[model samples]
Target: MDINYLLIHHDELLTYLREHDYAETYVNRYKTTIKQITDNASNHNWTTYEDVYQWYVDQSYSPTYLHEVRAIIGKLEQFHLHGNFPDNKKSYSSFWKIKSAYTKLSSEYKQLYEDFETQTCKGLKSSTVASYRTKISSFLYELQCKGATSLSDVTEKDVLTCFFADGVRKRSGSLCANIIRFFKILSESGNEEATRILAYIPNLRIARKNIDYLTDGEAAKIRQVLEDSNYSLSCKDRAVGRLLLHTGLRGIDIACMQLEFIDWNNDRIRIVQQKTSQPLEIPLLPVVGNAIYDYCINERPMSASPYLFLDSRAPHNNLTTDGIGYSVKKIMSAANIRQEKGRRKGTHIFRHHLAIKLLSNGVPQPVITRTMGHTAPESLSSYLHADMKHLRECALSVEDFPMAKEVFQSCLK
Candidate 1:
């Protein structure tokens, strides 16, 4: 467990990383960081994780730099334990972390929350379950802060205070509605206090908003970046961008895409939709097909993962949802699109753009619904707001209500 012992194998580690295809620049960085740690250890004595943690804290460096240092130390630990670097993976316990408030709750309240978790998660998808767990934790944390130690101690006033604690306009109506449903479930289970709390929570009405999509000019610029070979985008980045632009696949779905999903002979791409758990199949256009082929054959990292895309780093794994979104953001920056302050630049914009384009082209609603893998046809209605061509056709003539053109002649003059 001695940190100094690990430092002795540093040369071997660098050689191993190099053999595994780590970038030369990154290898040089690792060399410098390890040298600093080694030199500091020689001046003083440090051998354990605690010593390394204190050393990290004493250094006057930004949080980002400290995090990088921590990653290096983690790599060293992996080398020492496994005799080689393993794939990037989070610890098992990281997935089960509970909020400090949950730990401090009374046994009864803790049981209540645990029961809510178990009951609510049944037959739910992983993503939906994760979301519900987070909102429930936030709700419980606020309730505990407001001094409600148990269900019996919870008052209507405490409910309102905790609900509004997230701030007025920002208060999550879905969260409150979820809490109401939780209490209604408990009431059916013969808990009178849960029944009383139900009357305090009100139904929240959510309003629909216009979807954000790329304008014609912005779309043209993105297309130029994807189409032009002279652009500085990597093969992987180009592949991801083209998939979003041409297929309208959700970022998560694209991140989870497998190599076998592409039916090259049939010219189609197929996968189960992540959000809705439904199967979707779409034609593989030449542009998207070519880009993917370029990345897979020439640029993709050597990995045993069945995923179509892998990270550029060693122990390359499937790209994550955030990673896919970041690729889109980077492409946008390169294209000089959405550079204005507070402009939306996420991958979902490409989805909206695709929907609007199809709608404008008079593509049937059922076709758009199937292409986007929407569970219901009604989901396609939102993009109609951005379908400017269709909106124009609905406009009526103002000639009937006009007083006279001559009445405005003086103002025109």
Candidate 2:
């Protein structure tokens, strides 16, 4: 635990990391970084986290190298402080930049932003809150740039102009909806200006697009790949693929699923939906259960982390939603299932497939909505397009029209 122990026992740290399955190349890079820090610093007595951080800053390394050096030093700091390597991704520094930007807004608008953020954080997921904060912050910043000192000064023209800015058109509906919600929050807080602003902004009705889903054959192929012992997928990948395919869980739900969520005795898995914040209980089929069991027993990393899944590499941490999506894409590629243009290939595709399957089997819309953790029955309406059998049932009889057969024959001729 000595201050210079990291410098003195550098080789030992590398060996320990290697033993824990850290890639050889990464360990070598760590070695090089350690040498650089020891060569440049006057004293290696890095005791506190702040002390190590300060020493790194004083080195005046380039941004890229600074990040690299800081990462290595962080590992050493973790070892000294906690007697183990770090197990989570480092929090990004951009968060502080965002907070600073928020503090710089006009006092009235800043208070509005605070209230909007507080309301969002009450039940929204962290990712959703971050997105809302970024979009709303940008809107406020633009208003400030336009010399608008108060909410009343933000006219309809300003809102329209902002909507036409780059990248806003694609997300116009969602962006406008968020703005409406923000105005609603302000109006509820007794801001008459916000009530006026709300009248000017309309939530654009977005057209409902057809849901993309895997056909029975495509799903079977992907499931086969997951179950094949010779397919060369990592344990984590197989387990994740099966979980999405069988349980119809979203990527974020799979990412946040903890070990305690699985009820072994009851053969069910319970989780709070990341997007809706509603609790969901899915029956754990044997195929899905066996895949997860195999992973936990034979393939999962040996870590004290309570998450059901973790990164396969060293400093193992729970997978993120993006990581889960990447794994699903890899599984699809291995099965030779290339997603068609304009069709989504993420984990949500499995959910769509499951919903369509249930609909085809005569499952009620409300039941489908409940199973998928949807808050409204209207959310299940999109799957109607994917249910060809049900659509066929609504077809008009050919005999209803006298000229229908003659016209069909003439067209064929």
Return the TM-score for each candidate structure. 0.81, 0.78
The Cα local distance difference test for each model comes to 0.80, 0.79
lDDT of 1 at 95: 15
Native-referenced Cα lDDT, model 1: 0.80
Global local distance difference test of model 2: 0.79
| Superposed model 1: Cα runs more than 4 Å off | 1-15, 24-51, 77-101, 165-170, 187-190, 202-210, 395-413
lDDT of 2 by residue, 240-271 (tens): 99888877898989999999999999999999
Range of the 10 consecutive residues with the lowest summed lDDT in candidate 1? 88-97
Tens-digit lDDT track of model 1 for 1-413: 36556677888888887897788887887788777777777666765654665677797788988776666666665576666563555431221245445566667777876788787777668878777656666676677778887777788888777656566743567776777777777788888898988888767665665555789899899999988988888898899999999999999999999999999999999998888888899999999999999999999987788999898887788999878978888889889988788888888888999988999998999989988899888888778887889898998877767867787787789
- State each model's C-alpha RMSD to the native: 4.2, 5.5
Winning candidate number (lDDT) = 1
